[model samples]
Target: MDSHRIIREAEGEVWVSCKIPGKPTIRGSLTSKGISSDEVPEVTASEEFVVQEVTKNRITVSCPEENISCTFLSPYASFSHIHEKNVSYLDISSGGDLGVSSSTDQTFKVWETHNTEVKSVLEGHTRDVFSCKFFPSGQEVLSGGLDSLVKVWSVNDGSCLATMKGHRGSILDIAVVADGQNVISSGQDGTARLWDSAQGACIAVVDDSYSPINAIAVAEVGNAVNLGSPKETPSNREVGTEGKLVVLAREDKSLEGVSLHSRQSVFDFDGSDAFNCCTFISSVGVLAGGLDGNIIHVDIRNPKSAVETVSWSETPVLSLVPFRDTYVASYGNGTCYIPLKGSEQVLQLTGPNRQPVFQVAAWKKLVYTCCRDGFIRKYEIPDLG
Candidate 1:
């Protein structure tokens, strides 16, 4: 493999451009304000290009003799490692050392992200394991599956510590609190529930939508954000637990938010189509992607209207992840878009086999995508020049 890195620097906006061995000349720009400018550079490649100019907000490269000039940000992520198995869901640990992946093979495994070494194989689910994630502690893992059970495992020994059961349908997604004591899950049975990871007890049913809940995310909202009330307060919770919300993507074509602690509905916004996944870009801003290939951004405080709707491809959006100053969305067609605020064009994640990208997880500067092609594609963001 050829080693190359595209460097970027930020001023008011960041500009990046570079050339890769087998890929075309990469170019683009990223802004924090979601503004696009025509002044942005073009994409070009040549047998040779020279660094022509450098500015706080811009970098220019040109092949003077070939008359090729391109300016703007270059691609930020490059292919890293690939794990072979039809991955259904995956998450990187907070410390960025390990990854937990669940596959169509009905197995869940833990691996070292850096050198691609399989560390532990967790077994217990009788059916397909649909979701798996690293706890905030990174020493444990949480997984849910078609077996209608949630299992907690020790990352070091691969021993199943606890299994919580109740959902009538396949478990779709799982999220953990910052301290790892609590877990939140959504399922095909149209219910979202919170679990006490330590004791393996169902704390409460957060929602019963009557429509399959396709995906879920746990986000820590602003300290002052308020959620109404539940029948009972969640137990054994840590400090700052009041600020957490469970965002759900439902089969009813709606994006919903429920307080993790209160088990109360915060907001439910009708979407253009069935929501496939949801995530948070910040405490106040939430994003949901749907089967209509549209990704909608809304302000939690005023969700009467979407702040912005981005239509990238016609494939169902399977995953959304916050990346740097922007966010990345992956689709059923294996197309992934990383939107730069000020750039009209988005960065595309390449190297897919046109299979469904089931999940996306990021740790530090590295991004990981689990695909139906039985591959977990890894990408790394380059350092700034």
Candidate 2:
């Protein structure tokens, strides 16, 4: 008879031990940098068991004699009671210390990321707040809601600094431009608008897609791409508006890129299904998640077709966020995955229990996810070796 045990020796290393009655114990270890021997034997002479793979989220092991293979999911820290109803969205501050979350309960909260303690309640929205983000300065927040209004709030005191109203329908997503001087928002009104954050004025209607814009991402485009100059003199208040592109995920199953300065369409790629979220992975790369769970990666330089499309499930992808060399994606099936770039390995964040994960945010190596189950989960990814 034989016995075996597996243990996590440290953040990125796993140790396994196997023993047979009246025989010396066999030990081995696996690490992100591959097998190691300083802490434990790289592999025992018996080779009864082996550590097959190691990742930030889980480890896999196999034993031939036992004819068994098993996977162990890493543990995570969770902040419960963050919301009363479904948590619609969450964003971590640039400083990585604070976070803001909006819920279907018609409430938004600024909280301490260390412990998820409520810092302040932002209470101006008359309807469900659908989207929220921390400004680059991390001292304020911008939010859009079902009330068809965009509000900026002071993080220090939770005061509504300004309310910008223009959309005839609910605001679905929001993006803050450089330095927080200006912001952009998309809505059910089928329009994307750029607003002067301080004055609560709409600088321009960036795009009128004639279909609901479900999500948007703003980033500086490559220098070679021509962003036509503004027809009229640009507003002096529009900081970081030039050379930037806004990617719109439309309900009409199209992903379009519009130049911020000229409000001209850069490219429009037809998608297989309605896109629910989008994000910029690089200066020239964009990723959009569709309702059918397809994650389409497109090169803005040549947006005639997608560079790659991957789908893990038929469930709708609710959120897409670039993290390190990879991106984290959340689905309506309560699953979240971190697909490592240039690798076949994918890390899954466990705990949602089939409850739809509405959003995923990353800061440094920490990943935060909000779910319909009213819990905010924080995953501290071990430093990759």
Candidate 3:
């Protein structure tokens, strides 16, 4: 099989694409035993009732701190070393190159796992590039920072392509919204700005909050599932792109988060500030994590709004990230990893090294956490466990 070819499952059946001419396809049942990240036993199954085949390979999964080892195999390359300077965010490009924006070094590094070397350093963001990502086509780079500027650069030459302004305060987060044509930016400025990605211009300002918007995700609405184009824009419309952003506007000066849609705070008050560090479950329309270390599932489609809420902390919570439908919340005291519909047993990871976690990003079963102690630890996740 050609390692580069796609071999992932699509429907009920397992899939394998053998790029090599003489190679045989690997096939099996998709039943993997589950366990917690700390090596605790767990029941493993696909909650959706669709059982695909799981394949085996040469790689072994290990967690030194937990003293756990398991046989695991995958088609893609695995990142083995822990990142330096507490990785605040880890983004993967289409080519699988990693963009690790950090606070420890106060710089963004581009890494290639094949060479195990940093290919380039995105050195423009003066402060931490809190949110950095490649465009959908992976031709350009976009980053926001405490510097209050959103910079776009060419992926090939690494030269500045365009700089979008208007963020009065530190830009905490950003998203390539409106189907890659527009960029949605949120910051301490208490407003979410919609910017023209190609023109590097601010189109509209969604000023629904007096508090900092920690995160914003744009989702296409019905009929307007597409965005405003330059040539196709209406004469009466002020902005070109018009898509709904699922923004988590944290209340003034704290973790109090509000779920926003269509430039309005529709769902509010779940915690001291759950919306501040919360993340929306993809395809599920649930907002997870807020104040009181709890995650609130707000169904935007529902009238009552409050669908479900889960408390993972007593201490002031910092962030909540979704690993599939399940989520992990980082607080001052500990980190709680939970699955929604299946496992009730909360996987708690706490230690001397586990300082207050500020932000977290997970890939596959690997987690990258940024802490106040200025250290980042990578741990293997128990997907089924």
In order, candidate lDDTs are 0.73, 0.82, 0.54
Give the least accurate 10-residue stretch of model 2, judged by summed lDDT: 1-10
Winning model by lDDT: 2
RMSD of 2: 8.6
Question: For model 2, how does the per-residue alpha-carbon lDDT over 1-385 read when each residue is reduced to its tens digit?
Answer: 1112223344354455443334455565544433454453232223556667654455556655644444444436776687888888999999999999999887799999877789999999999999999999999999999999999999999999999999999999999999989999999999999999999999899999689999999999858477787788888878888889999999999999999988888899999999999999999899999999899999998999999998755689999999988888888887787755554445666677678989999999899999898888888765432
Model 2 bad stretches (over 4 Å): 1-57, 61-75
lDDT of 3 by residue, 1-385 (tens): 1111112323232221111123333322223344336543232222222222233222222233223222322212334243545556655565545544455568676665345466666677777777877787767778898889998877666677778889889998887763466777888878777677777887767554677887765554433222223343332323323444354546552332222223434434434343556566754365645555556666555525467755544566677677765776677654544443453333443321435667666666665555655554455555555
Q: Which is superior by lDDT, 1 or 3?
A: 1
User: Given candidate 2, what's the lDDT at residue 347?
Assistant: 62
**Candidate 1 lDDT, 1-385, residue by residue in tens:** 0011123312243333444334465454433332236433322323344555443333445544434443333333322233345788889998999988888777788988767688998989999898888877899999999999999999999999999988998998888777778788889999988777778888778798799999887777855367766566446543345778878889899888888767778888999899988888988898999899889998998889999987766678998999887887888877676765764334556556467888888887777888887777776644422
**How displaced is residue 277 in candidate 2, in Å?**
0.4
